[model samples]
Target: MVETSKVVVFQVGNEEYAIPIRFVISIEKVEGITPIPHLPDYMNGIFKVRGELIPVIDFERVLYQRPSNINELTKIIVIHTNELSLGVIVKDAKEIIDIPPEKIKQLGLIAYGKTSYFTGVANLDSRIITLIDPLKMVQSLDGIKQIQDFMAAEVNT
Candidate 1:
């Protein structure tokens, strides 16, 4: 028996990226975010959702090394992995898709360094979506442990 992976697809720049639906908590509009200092530039800041503060990271900054082109269509994709809940800002939240195992291919070695989080690429006809492991993505970042610790303390308080 084979199982298909359900993913939430979202736009970042001209490319499309997907994260498994299991990690997604919610998709929210960009209402407001309070900027925090001394964090990485990609770390946008913290935002409130349901009385809980979630650290926001710009997907564009993480991918393209620039600020996200925030607009009315921009959204924050809340994802929880390894006990940490983070909000990633994206150009837009597209839709959920299911990719069969046969359609997924492992990325080449050239994409292994900075993009180690990319588990595979799914080709659904003409659409090519990069699949990312949210856990690995978060773990690959430097100083994310500090943010995780901060979040833990916030939760305890």
Candidate 2:
């Protein structure tokens, strides 16, 4: 029997994406996001949530090449990965659903090449939703240390 995993569904741009619910710690609104200089463009900034500072990533900008626009629909999805506790900013988040392993297909190299942020594709009700691996997404970025350094400098300045 194949194992099934529950995922939290969210939307970026016009596409629907899912992330394994295990890694998702929480979802909340962030009032203020402090910009960090010298960091990658996708790194939106840092926000203080419940007394903890967490880096926010612009998923739309990174995945869909869309401009980052924060509005009423904006939400911060907190993902706890091995190296970092990061927040991914999405336009909106949908309900969680259970996805069977059999429904997930290993995307071809070309498909993965185009959407490298997605780990696999899960088909549901004749629709395919991209599955995202938070750990890979968080660790694959090049300017994480720059973000940390900038955050530190902001603290000391």
Candidate 3:
């Protein structure tokens, strides 16, 4: 039997990106993000979902070094890993697509310098989507340790 990864595709700027569906909690409408102080520019703030506080980050800023322009189509892709839970702001949540292992190409060494989180690219003939490992992306962020500790404490209290 062959294994195909199901991923959630989302828009950031003009490109489409994908994350493994297993990590996604939900697709939320952009709302009620309470800005906090002293966070990295990429860290938008924190928000509550079912009483759980999850730190939010801007996908565009993390990728392009510019904040995302929020509009009606904007959304938050809530995902969680063993380390922490987060809400990533995206221009739009596109669709879920299945990517076969054969269709995914690993990133080259040169591309790894900055986008270490980019696991591969899915070639679908007409278009390609960059595949991201959410855990790696979140871990690579500056000040993530403090954010993880804060989230852990929030969960405990």
Candidate 4:
């Protein structure tokens, strides 16, 4: 038997990136966000969907060391991993494509960065897309609680 994966492709700036479709909840339009203090600039803040609050991360900042590029094509990709739901801002949400195991190749650190967000590169006939590691894409270290507290406080006020 052979293994294959369905990936959700998204654009960040000029580059196209993808993540396993299993981790994606949905792709949403960039309506607005509630800002939280004392967090890194990459921590774009939080947004609500069907009464559920999800943290939005500026993925471009985390990977490219710059803020996300907002335009007509921009979108927020809601992804879930390890029981946590996060919204990743991308220049655009593209499409879902299938790639077989053989088409995926490991990327060298020098190819991206020391702590690359991607695990492999998918060599598709039309375009090359970086397959992301959702587990490693965003760290749940600090400021998570800060956002939670801010939300809680708002409810009480």
Candidate 5:
């Protein structure tokens, strides 16, 4: 018996990215995101989910340092982790795919500098999808402390 990890494949511009399906809450249409003062451009802002407000982030901006194009194909993936819960805008929300341990490659030391957001790379058929750790991505930002403070101080008030 082999253990398999379920993952969701999504697009940021032309690049395909993946996250463990267990971290995903839902796939939703891009909604109105309320902008916050002093927030990073990649932070996008916050949106209401049920009664809770989740900060949204631009996947393209965070990973590629470019703004994500919001069009008909774009969607927001609501992801939750122990440290952060937020929506990530992706160009297209592709289907969920299973990644077996054998197909996933661990990142080497050379891949460490700028690829901190990605935990590993998944080879899914003909294409390779970089697996992003959304929580880590948020945690690594320069304004993360402020975002955390905002989330704690204002978001609930």
Candidate 6:
């Protein structure tokens, strides 16, 4: 049997990106940005959804090291990893694409440096879609520990 995977394509800034659909729980309109003091710039803030406070990350800022423009198309993607659940704001979501295992390509070292967030590349219609590794991207956050600690404190308080 062959294994197939799906990617959730989205836009950030002028570039297109995708993440494994398994990591994404849902996508919704951006909302409830409550800024926290002394937090890293990339950490947008926290938002309450379904009775849980989820941290919102500026995807553009994290990858491109610049602030993301907020427009009507801006949306929040809810992603859940084994240890954490958070939201990432993107310029827009394109569509989910099904990629056969054979269609996926391991990106070369040169391309990996330019797109560190991506785990590999998926080729479709002569166009390449970067597959972002959500764990790697989230681990790159400088203040993730702080956010975790803050959440713990909030629970205890």
Tell me the deviation in Å of residue 48 in model 4.
0.2
Runs in model 2 deviating more than 4 A are 110-117, 148-157
lDDT tens string, model 5, 1-157? 8898888999887888898898899998888889887888789899888778888889889778999889898999998988778898899998898888999897783257566878888886899988877767767777777777888886667
- Pairs that clash in candidate 4: none
Instruction: Return the lDDT, model 3, position 87.
Output: 98
Q: What value does the lDDT take at residue 50 in candidate 6? A: 85
RMSD of 1: 1.5
Better of 3 and 5 by TM-score: 3
* Each prediction's TM-score versus the true structure: 0.94, 0.85, 0.94, 0.83, 0.92, 0.90
Deviation from native of the Cα of residue 18 in model 5, angstroms: 0.7
Q: Write one digit per residue (lDDT tens) for candidate 6, span 40-123.
A: 898888888788888888999987899888888999999998658889999998899888988888877525554566677788
lDDT of each: 0.91, 0.81, 0.91, 0.80, 0.84, 0.83
Q: Estimate, for each residue in 82-122, the C-alpha lDDT of model 1 and write its tens digit.
A: 85889999999999988899999998942667789999988
Stretches of model 5 off by over 4 angstroms after superposition: 109-111
By lDDT, is 2 or 5 better? 5
Residue 115 alpha-carbon offset, candidate 2, angstroms: 4.4
**Tens-digit lDDT string for candidate 2 (13-71):** 87889999999999988568888666788887788877778888898878766765778
Error of 5 at 62 (Å): 0.8
Question: Given candidate 1, what's the lDDT at residue 44?
Answer: 86
Q: On TM-score, who's better, 2 or 5? A: 5
- Listing every candidate in turn, what is its Cα RMSD in Å to the true structure after a full C-alpha superposition? 1.5, 2.7, 1.5, 3.2, 1.6, 2.1
